[model samples]
Target: MTAWRCVFADGPVDGKVVLVSGGAGAVGRYAIQFAKLGGARVIATVGNAEAAASASGAGADLVLNRHVDDLATAIAGFTGDANGRGVDRFVEVAFGANLELIVKTISPNGVVASYASDAVPEPKLPFWPLVMLDVTIRFVLVYVMPKQAHLEAAEAINSALEAKQLTHLIGRTLPLASIVEAHEAVERGDLGKTILVLP
Candidate 1:
């Protein structure tokens, strides 16, 4: 629902350049797939080799290390827009940490759909720059999404699943008795999805 809301709610992503930050993470991975499925060119950023591989597997056209020194230049090069007019849509995981980068790289009138901001829960925005770019900042929380949005997302997900267009990555699966272990893994930021099976 979060991915669908971020990728499709604003408009069709066809032919657009969509950037997914933390593209190996759960939401980021889904966003990458959805953007690709919608015919958008996708660029995903990750912190490690494993994450880079995961994002690539999820169908990102370009996967870059988020810690690169000149991220904006790299993005511009990938988009082939020398003018630094970056992605049309951004699915951000660390909105606060990436605010400056977003402001620098997002195209005019682009939309930024952010789901998490653990790094800085309260971030100060570069108001003038964002305003000048006419950027739309959307904070998404799946639990509070509108009923209609949920329905729309569910339908899309079902269609995608039926068509075998979606894939899930299970990092670990543990019996119900091992729930505490599963919780610990999640707290440690284990990669992929963790599932607890009921015996």
Candidate 2:
């Protein structure tokens, strides 16, 4: 989130319907809340009831089971009443895994903004549809930056946070000794911040 999460504070993701793939995961939890606070509608995909509860409590508008009978139909149904025909954007955690279905579900000119990729390196991008729909694929690289710009952005974000306008959805809290297990849970899609408490 140190990188991709900035999308929210920057307002580029404001007021959009962002379909989050790992919507109940660590990043997903915060992404959901931040999007809502930013005035966007959040459609999150959770693995089960507990995750759904957590997401809803954190402010997600709709939390759907990822094991749904039909992802496309479900997504389409969710965004049916959208001001726009389909989702305005996607905060995708599994872009490669969900690319085909995302393409089928998104409206023309919709964008898939992704960050997670531990598998399937270099998958082919849908160039034609992207061009036809005028979709933009944006990547966030956090390492490269000038300190001045970073400070400016940070100041702005801090101002928003101080105003209580930017909400952060923090998930499970873990004890210091359980850090490894906590990390595992996050990788397994346990949503929210894996905070370690020191005794």
Candidate 3:
């Protein structure tokens, strides 16, 4: 959290319009709030109204429905661009699903910070355009977290929570016995924070 907050809130996140695809999920939720805290207009995309509300409530300036036929077009609309290049930064969850559009939407010298890029499809790179604009791509790995890192993340989270600036969508809480159901619930794709009940 500290590193993310530093890299975002106190560092790269300021003065930029940031886009968060899958922005209603756990990581995205915090990312939105963190971005807002440091003064960034956030464009969040969700799968439904529930997610939209959650993201908007969490301080996203704009929310778009991912189910919309043209997700990239919607982003362009928000950026006030007919072709994209309005965004200054992007926090992407699914690169294969979103990179092509994000690349086009970002302004010159913009960056794409990717946290998770699981199976979506084969990604095609626009090497020509990227070379022209000098856009940068970064991939974040969560496994590197240490105790000190967790402490920083906790502080950032607490700061947002204390300021009443953070909002999250919690689907359900199940006891350990229902772990199977919990796993299946996660597959629903619309759920967030399926917290397990500890004894």
What is the C-alpha RMSD, rounded to one decimal, of candidate 1? 0.9
lDDT of 1 by residue, 74-169 (tens): 889989887788699999999999998898889999999999999998999999999998999998988999999999999999999999998888
Each candidate's TM vs. the true structure?
A: 0.97, 0.76, 0.83
lDDT of each: 0.92, 0.67, 0.75
Clashing pairs in 3: 1-153, 85-105
Lowest lDDT 10-residue stretch of candidate 3: 2-11
**Candidate of highest TM-score:** 1
What's the CA error at residue 181 for candidate 2, in Å? 4.9
Return whichever of 1 and 2 wins on lDDT.
1
Q: Write the candidate numbers in order of decreasing TM-score.
A: 1, 3, 2
- Candidate 2 achieves a global lDDT of 0.67
lDDT of 2 by residue, 63-95 (tens): 888776466776678778443347777777777
lDDT of 2 at 7: 44
- RMSD to the hidden true structure, all candidates: 0.9, 3.5, 3.0
Question: By TM-score, is 1 or 2 better?
Answer: 1
Tell how far residue 5 is off in model 2, in angstroms.
Answer: 4.3
The segments of candidate 2 whose C-alpha lies over 4 angstroms from its true place after superposition are 2-15, 81-85, 145-153, 164-191
Evaluation by lDDT, superior candidate among 1 and 3: 1
* lDDT score, candidate 1, position 150: 94
